[model samples]
Target: MNFRIISALVMRYLFLYSRSPMRLVELAFWPVVDLVVWGNVTVFIQKNTNPEFGSYVLFFLGGMILWDIMFRAQQGVAISFLEDVWTRNLLNIFVAPVRSSEYISATFIVGMLRILITAVVLSFISWFGYAFNVFQLSWWLIPFFLNLMLFGWSLGMISTALILRWGLAAESLAWAIPFFFQPVVAVFYRVEDMPAWSRPIAWCFPPTYIFEGMRDVMKSGTMNWDYLGYAAGLNILYLALAGWLFVWVLNLTRKRGLLTKFATQ
Candidate 1:
């Protein structure tokens, strides 16, 4: 946990993005696209549905905002690691004084920074474009946002560990793995909307509880501590497991002398 090393690593990544216009656009691309597509759909539904059905824009926009948090958080770490692999720099990094913990710490910080940028930008668009303010949902927004970020970070760790062990063949997991949970997360729909057979699997994801609670608050104007509590507890467990798995995989890679293979391939 050397702060100097962590700062250096963070600066390195910042410099990479700062120099590349395409990379900066990529950070905002998917999120803005998701908001526009879903925002319009939400508006259309509101006009067509019975007024009794109530406004759905909040739910739709809220889900999209939170889901992107998870996406950006996961990509922030997993892709940062992949950048090292793509540039053949992993060996150079590890051969230096940088420890695994320090590297992860720096990536986590950068990921959070990305989340903040995305959150603020999306929040503005949802407000002006759709007349939906996520902040109005509740004060509980803070905890729910944090819970989703942690879950994303845990998933990123697992993805990185898999890539480290199997090489670039598994690099697709960095982008593909997060979407695997999207169906189960029930982001735009309730858990009940999931097939009965898949309900249990959906519940296994912590975001399911957060979204469920989000819907509860939207409908009743009250927060459900139970859902937030469940999300927090599950995040702690998953994050610990992810951390352990990453260290285990890194050790195996070193034992087999595969860092060169990971870096060069």
Candidate 2:
């Protein structure tokens, strides 16, 4: 409700990142590594073995861009409280006029902004460098991308609440959850090449649908409504679950006085 307070927090977060731009390089590591390793590997494989693999590489790259957006957004939500714990600024924030709900709202807005910025940067690079033709022409994916971003924000907030409860030990959860999508992404050559049982696990990640959709749109110029609906539905359900979990965790932490238990550390 207090847009001013939320906007202030969002601006502060962006300013901090602007001051220490090197930190972005640290955040950009995973996506760049993905682009380099898989980019060359896919080109090599397709040139020598199967040219079909070339499209797979492009699809995977797009998925990496989306995955990176999710990862960065999660980091924003999960680590927003870390500075307060690490540097003692959180005490001042709590003592300020802002309520917990306002703070939570600020975190969500910042996370979405972070994800959108990353998506734009990655999209520019992919389109020019590799001739990523899928999203270049199809602007319809914007709504789908926004939905995925909302789902990611909800999950990020839940992870942030866990971190607020257990401290830095919960940091691993942020990375671990996103890491599972790596092998399932299109960059991995062939999903069918993997074991039969693993195929189901790979399909479970929403980005798989995203990659498939991008490929279909690029190659066939037709949308895959079935896959899109399934992924969208699953994300909506997960977003609800994530919001519920975040609220529960936040209440528990407040009651237990665990939100600041590790602040002095």
Clash tally, candidates in order: 0, 0
Model 1 per-residue lDDT tens digits across residues 53-116:
6475568888889899988999888999998988888889988999999999888988898899
Q: How well is each residue in 176-199 modelled by candidate 2, as lDDT tens digits?
A: 665655676443345666778787
Which model scores highest in lDDT?
1
- Candidate 2 global lDDT: 0.68
C-alpha root-mean-square deviation, each candidate: 1.2, 2.9
Give each model a TM-score: 0.96, 0.83
How many clashes (backbone atoms < 3 Å, residues ≥3 apart in a chain or on different chains) does model 2 have? 0
The TM-score of predicted model 2 comes to 0.83
Give me the runs in candidate 1 sitting further than 4 Å from their true place: none
Question: Where's the lowest-lDDT run of ten residues in candidate 2?
Answer: 181-190
TM-score of 1: 0.96
lDDT of 1: 0.89
